[model samples]
Target: MRPFIASPSNARRTRSREGFMTFSPRKTPTTSQAPQGSPMLEWTGERYLPWIKDAAIAYEHLHRYVLAARLAEGKRVLDLASGEGYGANILAAAALSVVGLEIDDAAVQHARKKYKRENLEFVTGSVTSIPLREEHSFDLAVCFEAIEHVEDREKLVSEAKRMLKPDGLLVVSTPNKDVYRHESAGENPFHVRELDFEEFRSLLRQFFKNTGFLGQRIYANSTVWQIGNAHDARIDEFVIARDTAEFEFATNDRRVPLYFIGLASDAALGKFPGSVLIDCSNELLRQIQEALAWRERQSADRAETIASLEKAVAWRQTQLEDSLEAIASLRRVAGELETGNADLTARLRDATHQLGLIHASRGWQLILRLRRIRNKLKALVTFRVPG
Candidate 1:
């Protein structure tokens, strides 16, 4: 694929920077393996990193979901930042043809060797300057976890728009910086800027007719890390200017949230009542708030029930210990009695038997109490009381 000459001067200037470069190291292609193109892939050595495997899997699953919903069979697909070719390979299983481009040579080689499907191909290129020449060539484009690495994000969005068919769909995901603070202290050396929800939305609004952000994926809570991963990661999908009317009304009505799903088309503009978008946005926000409130109440009830159970357990344990001590005292008294003191021994044995029954009853009682408390908590948390 030939690289587009959209910004040759900018690329040259970036290459000539003399200061301590903050940008990640770019990969150099082998002498014999380099493609005969102006935009030689700058290897970032990211493919050799072990974390990329998990990242690739996550990207693949997400892309499959988006494509299945948006694209029909035999649609042309492009996998932007298609690291190690895993995403493209997955997409190739459903799409007519899939083209994947990456900046890492090792990744390109790995993908080429492992995934040799006939409908799939891989190239080395950058998102800011895609190698393809045809405008409106692709029906769908998937760019995941790539915007943070680029210096000029606006240009990247423009490039994506230029390459898409008028009504083509673009699915992009980025980390929610507001929800997740980079634990690495911003020293990754690869990422330029991490964006929160609003920043990302603003960037996309400049090019695409419609943009919608989806909330993060949820996972089990971790005690080791205090923060709950609630709506932490986000994906933003954009559409070109085919039906701009729908999006224009939505934007004007201020119905879209920082994270949402939206539909847009140029033909949709001025056709629908603007108030419809407002109502939809309001309804969505209300639902989200209600869900969050419900979750909080459930968590609180659980905590209270756990605390009560612990207290009951402690009390039962103390009672059992006291009964044991009493039984031990009776045995000592029987032992001190004369050898022929059958009455004293009999009394001690009876006392011990009674204590055992008490212990058993107490254990059952504690169990029942805990069960009742749990049931009550569950009911209280989940029950919708009638007005």
Candidate 2:
């Protein structure tokens, strides 16, 4: 977990997983109960491990505790920069006593309220300049992932060495510089400094007599996730090695290792426990697969609905087009009828004018008079013959 107490400046405080540690593939018993933003530290889904939405993120964030738990057994542990105290609480299960030191006041108060065992205690302090007065008292001092946040690396390392007994073990970790630098989209704005493996080793060598590093790489099942870290293609074998630093390098950068853990002591660390913890969020993975299936079903239903709407729209458009064609045909017929009526009216007016002209002629009047006289003479002749 990230802790800001060791950072170069006070502004570098967004450090994640630096100050915290918790046992169980899930989380510690205490911090899980309290909701984020209550008396306990806020359970930011993206930042904190216990209340994280994705199980894979939670696993990757908290698995360091599993690796460190083996070494801190039955020892008085000083968890530096213990932001939320869960890491210290987890170690408390195995350690004789755990003093969780944090600089952030809210986190310290939150931790005190959430995880209060007789063996577990929370204190407000910085890792670079540890506030603990008791020097050379602790059996083991553990700083999981807080070293890189601080500006003064040497001071933090020296402080950790100071807290531990003459033969106490100092377990510390940092993001591998080569992988973290390139693998990250860009430099983290929250991080003041990030170290490569060589730089990290070089830094640790100054304070600790013998520093043995153990790499923590997360691998996902093929069926489960297409995103996140996958096994290296060049990985031909998986065998137990006596040394903690021994790891088979992946051929490509696609499967770059996530973080590195170092076990520092005066003498050589011989024959560590062969057990390696896998941060494969199988439970969360199953849930995600189910959710994906549900989403696909929803998408198919939406597509069907959209197709039906488009078909209806096409049918309506066709009907409107046919109506428009029929209206145009009716308009043409109406135009032809109007033209025929206009021609007929013009012909009738012309005929009327010709008849009027004939009636007005002088020859026509003379013919009428002649016809009347002839009829009268014919009537007189017929009457005399009859007598």
List model 2 lDDT by residue over 44-109, tens digit each: 321354654555555655677766666778889899877667778888888888998887778888
Candidate 1 lDDT, 1-387, residue by residue in tens: 001111222222232121111234334343233333323334333222212223322333443344433352588888877875666877888898888877655568767876789989998777778888888888777776667667777887778878888887776766566543432233334445668877887887777777654543322121222257644333232322325545322232222222222222212222211111012234334656777999999999999999999999999999999999999998888776755477778899999999888768978789889999999998997787765
Cα error of candidate 1 at position 12, Å: 20
The residue-level lDDT of candidate 1 at 281 comes to 34
The global C-alpha lDDT for each of the candidates, from Candidate 1 onward, is: 0.58, 0.70
TM-score of 2: 0.62
